[model samples]
Target chain A: MDLIQKSLLQQVAGLHDVPEGAYNIRVNGQLDSRNTTANIDIVTKEDKPGIDIIIKPGTKNESVHIPVLLSKSGLQDMVYNDFYIGEDCDVTIVAGCGIHNCGVDTSKHDGIHTFYIGKNAKVKYIERHYGEGDGNGENIMNPETIVHLEEGASMEMETTQIKGIDSTVRKTGGDLKDNASLEIREKIMTHGKQYAKTDFVVDLNGKGCSANVVSRSVARDQSRQEFFSTINGNNECKGHSECDAIIMDSASVSASPKLTANNIDANLIHEAAIGKIAGEQLVKLMTLGLTEAEAEEQIINGFLK
Target chain B: MDLIQKSLLQQVAGLHDVPEGAYNIRVNGQLDSRNTTANIDIVTKEDKPGIDIIIKPGTKNESVHIPVLLSKSGLQDMVYNDFYIGEDCDVTIVAGCGIHNCGVDTSKHDGIHTFYIGKNAKVKYIERHYGEGDGNGENIMNPETIVHLEEGASMEMETTQIKGIDSTVRKTGGDLKDNASLEIREKIMTHGKQYAKTDFVVDLNGKGCSANVVSRSVARDQSRQEFFSTINGNNECKGHSECDAIIMDSASVSASPKLTANNIDANLIHEAAIGKIAGEQLVKLMTLGLTEAEAEEQIINGFLK
Candidate 1:
């Protein structure tokens, strides 16, 4: 029984420590620490024709707390090479972080994440940043992210930036590849004095590539948030981007989504806006006796849902 | 000449005091006053047909601010009936207000405003809102506006929401009319902790009516902002709405633009987004030796140009 339990634990901790014909990164973590976890990959030390990468957070040496604001060292290193998904091969990567702290004082943090997805391989990554500290003193956090996508590959990435010490984030990422597709989505909500900034850039280098970006923000109290998304269609590629931000109470949100078409043949479409819960809809619900807050809640719930 | 200037001022002021067949509104104080403005024009007083109204703050009382945020108000009361424009009749209304003492710190604001257009009339209205007094407290505001259109009437509205005492705001509006058209444009910029929200909605109710809405937002510092818009089609109406918001430093923005089709025969389109000045575009200018900020400023100047 003990051997069996140990073997299961090892498998969960090292899900990505094997090489498959089709590139795939399967990450499963043990609930040992709140801030840090182990990374296992069955990558051969020998350099070859495969993709080369140098993760910024690297393997942890003790539970490291992401700072409220990113530091110079945090984002200094660039990944060695763009990850290549061999032609006709499928690749999927799931990478995420667990952030939790318990205390009364304010907290600030910054983190830098980088990614390079190579040609012909499809990669899907999920990123989650979550903290459990109660809203207290003014806290600021800035996190930066960058991504590069190569030709004939596809990527679907989603990020969830949830409650935490008041923080701000500046994230930058984009893709480049022929016939490649990238889908990016972010869900953010904050309270206290948290302020956040995020930026995304998509570059289509190969023909037939596509990009889709979406963002949703929810804020309350004195908190502030902002989102910037730029989708560039180069070399006759197609791109579509959408962003939505919702504000609650005294909280504020600002978002901009841009689509730049460098090629006349490029098919690009973009849409973005900021708004509160609809008044007419609220009235319709209120006529049925639902309170104002309840109506607002219903709208938000619908959006998030 | 002095007498002429005073007479002109009096005439403009008088146009606001009493609603007229010509589109007109005058305010001695802030139109966003929570108490009075919240319920302004909620129910069209039958006695005052052809005159649309809105509730706003009274400069006569220093105690009231942002009166348009009423806790209990009916949907119909928040709207004004058709303010007609006689066929080929040329008319203009000058509306301006000085507002101070808002509730939210580090916010942007757009006063609640709504409009109604009737058949065969041409109407023009210009509105400006500014902060007065010491500007000590942060002022946050949300203004709601809707426009109703009838056959063959045309309307144009211009607004500018500038500098504040750390205010935040959400402004939302739209139009509905057949053969009637509406044009709206606004410019906004903010520093300090000011955060702002602005939105435009257009619903073409009658055949051949058209609508256009355009706006821009600029923000700096730890502030935040957002813009949401929808250009909806109905009953063979045609409309378009466009918006852009720019962010600098730690500032942030969120925008969502939606194009909805209510009638298969109607044509409607809209675009919205928020983004930083492009880096590569700036770098290209910098390669020619322009400073980073100067390059960016030049790009912005070109965009505005």
Candidate 2:
């Protein structure tokens, strides 16, 4: 199956056709596996570059799709995926990474994921990162995620870095424990001299723990972005962090959302907003007839959907 | 007159006694032309440093209370006031500035006000800026205001800078015509190494002009703060700018709320937030038994009231 490995598995596992029962891992220029079942197990680390997914301990309905590809062109890769997710499980994970650089140097992807989930687990993690060809190269993604939820665990992480990725430094973090709950939804879009930075953290550690982190971003033209989120409410936990951005031409955005509490029955909140783009949302989509660059590309695709 | 000019006329013109029909300008240690009711006219320019208030064209029931003070401690002051609101007028302006430094050196105030609003005028402006004595000096204030709204005029501005000011740079601006409307409510507070910077602008030129800017701030300990608000929607206008901040400890805060829409039937919106404080609002004010610094001084006096 080649054609750039079926277009990087239909741009990151929205799989054109390949599901003899889910669980897949197909990294184009190297280790590839498929139709993985029997409660999950995928090994490909003869001591170095990436992959060893465990998952099995009661193992309820499971589904996984790990897609990674960087079709030649000054390749630079470093992957190390390790996820355990054991006790009483219910899972759905579809991780992504794609770059299909056509030349001119610089193609990098450094993914280091480690999730240990455990006690009463329920995880739904979906990730998407992409970039295309006809390239003057440089498609970089450096993602490092570490989550360990434990007591009555629950995690719903949905991440998206759509459109051609030029540079990214995203680090997702977690640790929630007693009655644990963590939800993160992030969507981003960048244009031109693109560059993105996201540093996230959520540590409500124990006693009815909860955390919700939300982000929505769109920056066009001279893109440069930064979203730093920190939510920490040590014990009687409940936290929230939010960021919303839409900036056009000569773009520049920086949202620093932070919340830290030390008991008093911890409860935290953070909010960030950067503006531009709301002339009545492009005059209500040009009164339904478009134009004005098609109503700013349909309001940046409903603001990165 | 003396006793620090009767405590700078009872802490900035809430004059312990001085009435007889309205319009007042009492700038102690310098320009004091008290009890001025002839429909506005106060001039003091022996060639330099500040004061020219004019408003006379068919002036109706005018009520103006100008407050300015700084009782000793090596005082440094600058004031330039100019306002002329004529046609079909209705006015109420209580401008404020107070500082009452005690010793060690540094007491400064710089105020520059300019407003020209005519045509169907309706104005209500209330300002309160204060700083107390018992000082090791250093209580500075710099304010610059400009407003101009002519055609169906309207202006409602309420500003408050509470607590002891140590440093400030506040610049307020406005310009709106046709069915003009402008509302500004700003409240600020700062602790220790106090430093505050507020830059604001609102410009919606004509047609159904509108603008609203709301800001609330509180920065504790080693204080440092910045809030920049900009709302510009030229023409079929409607604009909103909001900033909310509270950061404690080694306090530091920055919020930039901006909205610029150049008419596609302009409608703009902006929101900003900086966080800290709020652990369920200090556990519902310590379950009503107060303490926790009296529930954070009763939530910073109801968030700067």
Candidate 3:
């Protein structure tokens, strides 16, 4: 069953026509299964199902963003197993999950998505996870993304988790070659009593390579969140990792980052910290006439920004 | 002239007790040149002369602290290079400098200190840089410390930089092997216009290794601070690095931590952030009858706590 799913996902992901420039995507209104692209293939049955496509741009001009949205019921409820972005293409993929089907209750739901970027490809991927109102059941999402950058390739990835229905676990891995660089910024904000875990790993296999990982989390009430990151520098590779967390009220947050360097000349650094907001900042905002909640929100937004 | 200074510096470093778990130190508090370490050999006479020595443990396990006063006048009102700690054992070294000698008119004065740690040894190094009154100087302190950790070694390093200085730069490096570990923590608070930079690099070459680095900085006024850290992982090494900075008003801060993993099985992570205090904290403190400065100070202290 797993083999069939993997093959199906690969087939769907191999259909993209990723161009060499910027790609812009937008998913504004509701989209039905009948509106599927001719070049994209989607399946809804068992084993590797859902929508899959290769994003190949036809233009060679400025950068663009290729947007993807789950608007309608068929697209929203389908099981998306695998997703991949091809090599040597500078592209931006924006994906957002909207809450249109409001009345639903279940215990467990799994949505797995996989991404693979080719060597020397500069890709900017932004994922926005949000749900409106309060839905029942454990809505589980497992997004596994793997990126491989050849020599001189660079990638800037951003993941924002805001207001969710159930729980989320995101895992990401990347490989960088000589002079390659990878930068990942993540911001997670929640006030619900749920669990969220985001784990990231990057390896700099070549000489003079670099990596930057930064995460900011704000939790309120009984919410719990964990962030784990690891960066490895092998044989003259230079790698760096940074992790930070903020807890509010009864929220529980944990962040752990590890860095390892094997070569005598290799340099590595890792940092992790957990704390609350400062007092002086709150006073400054209160003096400006804003209420307590308003001030906290402003500071949270500014820190993430 | 430069050659002489380099040799003198090298000689002093060599006085570190070879490769034992003992600390050998020699000091001359007076400038008369008559009171000096008997084993001390001077290799240079020019600016920053090179010195060498071999120190044997004086059969005492007492807590040792050496004060290197940079404000002292030499043949021509020059600052003296203070040397206090020696090598080959587990020791706690405390080095501090005050801002009484340098007048307020000058804007640039460089003070540099060199330190070397041997294999299979543990060292707890505490550096406190503080000033009194308002007659501050553009003091530039560059303390270069090099540590070589053989099988089963560790280090706990702490630094506090506060008041009466225009700028500070600190660079620390360590080479670890055979389950060696290094832990460093720095707390920095600044008032007035100043610039400070803290940099640390730890390279893991052994099969089982670990590293932890943490830094906290509070900047007021138009002061600026930068922190750069790198942790390298090799041969199944585990490492971690973390930095947190709090800003007020126009205070600016920049922190960048890099973690590189070269081994496929090595684990590493890093975290960093720069931001101002929050507002809700202040409102709560105001309700408790604390003034703005008092509340802010409470917040700053709370962050360090």
DockQ, every prediction: 0.05, 0.04, 0.04
Over 4 Å off, model 2: A1-5, A8-10, A13-36, A40-63, A66-92, A95-124, A129-158, A164-187, A190-216, A221-246, A250-305, B1-36, B40-92, B95-124, B127-214, B217-305
Query: What's the best-to-worst order under TM-score?
Result: 3, 1, 2
Q: Summarize candidate 2's per-residue lDDT along A1-305 as a digit string, tens digits.
A: 66876776787767875655645555544766666678888877778888778888878777878888778777888888888889879988888888888899888888989899999789899899988877598899988898999998898998999778889999999988898898999999988988999989878889988888898988888878887777666677777777777777766666655555544455565555556677888998898898889899888888778
Recovered fraction of real interface contacts per model: 0.08, 0.04, 0.07
lDDT per residue (tens digit) for residues A40-76 in model 1: 2223224522123322222222111111111111121
RMSD each, Å:
17.5, 16.9, 18.1
Instruction: Please provide, for model 1 over B1-305, each residue's C-alpha lDDT reduced to its tens digit, 9 standing for 90 to 100.
Output: 13332232233233222333222332222122212233233233466322344323221111111111111111112222333233444455455333333332222334444444445656676555555334544444444555565567677877666655245454546555667788888777766667676666666677777788787766666666666666665566666677666666666555555554444445544575555666689889999999998897787666643
Error of 3 at A75 (Å): 36
Cα distance off (Å), candidate 2, residue B63: 6.5
lDDT of 2 by residue, B202-291 (tens): 888898888888888888888888777776666677777777777777666656555554444555566555566778989988998998
DockQ of 1: 0.05
What tens digits encode model 3's per-residue C-alpha lDDT throughout A1-305?
13322222222222133323333222322122222233222333345444453544321122332223332222234345344444566755554443322344432323445555555667676766654433543344455567677776777878776665357788889888888888888888767687788888887788777888888877777787777777665645656666666567666665656544334334555556555666789889999999998988898889777
Which order, best to worst by DockQ? 1, 3, 2
- TM-scores, all candidates, are 0.44, 0.40, 0.48
Q: For residue B63, give model 1's deviation from the true position in Å.
A: 42
